[model samples]
Target: MSRSTTATVARTQPKRAVLAAMLLLPALAFGLWNRPVDAQEAPVEIPAPATTLNETSASATAVFAGGCFWGVQGVFQHVAGVTKAVSGYAGGAADTATYDQSSNGSTGHAESIQVTYDPSVVSYGDLLQIYFSVAHNPTQLNYQGPDHGTQYRSTIFPLNDEQTGYAKAYIAQLDETGLFDGPIVTTVEPQKTFYAAEQYHQDFLTLNPTYPYIVVNDLPKVAALKQLFPDAYRDEPVLVGTL
Candidate 1:
């Protein structure tokens, strides 16, 4: 081939390579996006906690880490009695809580959400029921759907001894019934430091409903919450930063 033709071909090849990479940018941006074993994984309707704080009205906080906080936060936001749900990182140190750092899966931070609710209006037991049933898969060991890693593990970070007791009892209750085909692997972890994720991470599902990952993996979970617990599902989500 002529020298001029060789040079032209090299330049053309690089342009083609650039275009190819750009075409795959969407998938790259979201990271490993895995779908659950069953897209229609229905919520497990476990009995309400037999023991709960008798106080009919009071404010309380609960933190949950299951899969991606975007969907977990989204699910709780639509729950009737939850005042606010903020996506964040939990079970990790405060200094390593940034999203970019946590994404590496070595920061010991699991994507988590802080749910503030009026316990009087919605008991903590009710929240736990919804969490195990509708938020994400408890059988998933260290990941949820297309996402894999310890950062996506199913976990409950109870705030106190009472909350810890309730969580443990409920897991036992669900396990005995064989509610799940697989054993529930959710572990109760003591809260370390809950750090609110970046501004862009909060309220992501609500703002980006049509995004590919949300549509395929998360929207159905919300739909199940509405279908199974109509009384508890609210159409308008309670946003965190907004309140």
Candidate 2:
């Protein structure tokens, strides 16, 4: 009951409170240190493999039947980008479709030229330009000039997806640009079996230069290609045409 005894009791109470606070500090520090880490592990970064562009010599091939294979083949041969041109038959039934059979309009095959060109040199669009301007008449449906039948129809047989997309887009662009007076009847289909014509048909104009057909039909194509694409034509083209 005395003042000194009461003061002593209060000071002892303060020491007890400090000791309790020190005891709780370890639990609080441990809880802060052990806060939950992300349950998921850090994702690993895997390096991606390098992609490559195909650069084969025969990178891209397309078949086109403009009018006459002779003229078509000749025109493409002069083009800078064209690697080789083979007169052939396409869009036909799977059988031995030859010039004789195709011309008769019974084989359902077209008198086409298989053009192997380097995409790095010239684009497919440029090839189409040569096709429409000097290669053959796109306005003509199922026929080119005197030739009348599916054998002379205008078509671009695309070899790959890129070619397919480019073919469609080019046709659509030509249609929109009003390049042709009538509908562009050129068919863009997936490439099918291409049968190279017999050896005799390979370079008919170049061989038979003085032939009447070459003078009238084939020579004009050559001249037009030269005039249209002077850069593509060679001054000393093959002198195989000796009539």
Best of the candidates, lDDT: 1
Residue-level error in angstroms, candidate 2, position 55: 7.9
Q: What are the lDDT scores of the predictions, listed in order?
A: 0.79, 0.64
Candidate 1 residue-wise lDDT, 90-201, digit = tens? 9889899986677768989999999999976788889998999999889889877667788889989988887888899889988888778688999999856788887777
Runs of candidate 1 exceeding 4 Å displacement: 1-40, 55-57
Candidate 1, backbone clash total: 4
What is the TM-score of each predicted model, taking all chains together? 0.82, 0.70
Look at candidate 1 and tell me the lDDT of residue 18. Answer: 38
- lDDT per residue for candidate 2 within 1-243, as digits (tens), equals 442333223222332343334346766434433434221111111111122224355446778888768778877877887777888888787675765556666776888888777878755666766776677777789776555677778888877776677767766766776645577799887857788876666666676675433444566666777776676676444322222
> Model 2, 221: alpha-carbon shift in Å?
1.9
